[model samples]
Target: MDTLCGFMRDIGRHLSKPVVMTAEGGYANPVLGFDPAADRVVLLAQPRFS
Candidate 1:
């Protein structure tokens, strides 16, 4: 997780843009708190499929 976060941070630094993290279903909490590079975290409700 730390490694991934580091990589994301590096990418954000290189791109000079705020990275947005979208949560689908699993691992939402960690992505919200752990990702420092993510400027915004969007939590999406589960979609219902017909």
Candidate 2:
């Protein structure tokens, strides 16, 4: 879990947007931006499917 978090942090820091920590430990909050744009994040307390 630590390693995964580290990687996530690295990715988040490299982006210009915020990467929130979801209730599921970053599940619904995915890394947005497919092209060469600033990355964005969106985290929810619960998964939509749940």
Candidate 3:
């Protein structure tokens, strides 16, 4: 996760607009947290497939 955040920061720095990362469609457990320093929201959840 740290690696992902690092990549996001690096990419975000080069871009003019804000960056929002979202993950979808998985059967793993969710990870919920907030990074105040980066002002980033990390959300992980499983997708509902019928």
Candidate 4:
């Protein structure tokens, strides 16, 4: 997770636009903190299929 977060932070340095993050596949491991690079984050509950 550290590697992944490091990559996101590295990428964020070059981006001028606002970064929005979707917390996917992360509920299992549960990262309690939001990414510093993200301007906003969208957290989804477990999926419900019809």
Maximum-lDDT candidate? 3
Model 2 stretches with alpha carbons more than 4 Å out: 20-50
Off by over 4 Å in 4: 24-50
Residue 50 in model 3: shift from native, Å?
A: 23
Q: Which residue pairs clash in candidate 2?
A: none
Per-prediction TM-score, please? 0.42, 0.36, 0.42, 0.35
Worst 10-residue lDDT window for candidate 1 reads 28-37
lDDT ranking, high to low: 3, 1, 2, 4
Q: Which ten residues in a row have the lowest lDDT in candidate 2?
A: 32-41
lDDT of the candidates, in the order given: 0.48, 0.46, 0.54, 0.45
Candidate 3: regions farther than 4 A off: 25-50
Q: Write the per-residue lDDT of candidate 1 for residues 1-50, one digit (tens) a residue.
A: 56655665666666776444445765543332223344433233455599
Q: Provide the lDDT at 7 for model 4.
A: 56
Q: Is candidate 1 or candidate 2 better by TM-score?
A: 1
Residue 40, candidate 3: C-alpha displacement in angstroms: 6.8
- Writing each residue's lDDT as its tens digit, candidate 4 over 1-50 gives 67655555555555644333445865454432334445333232455599
What is the total number of backbone clashes in candidate 1?
A: 0
lDDT of 4 at 45: 44
Candidate 2 per-residue lDDT over residues 1-50, each given as its tens digit: 56655555567767644555544466755533222143333333444483
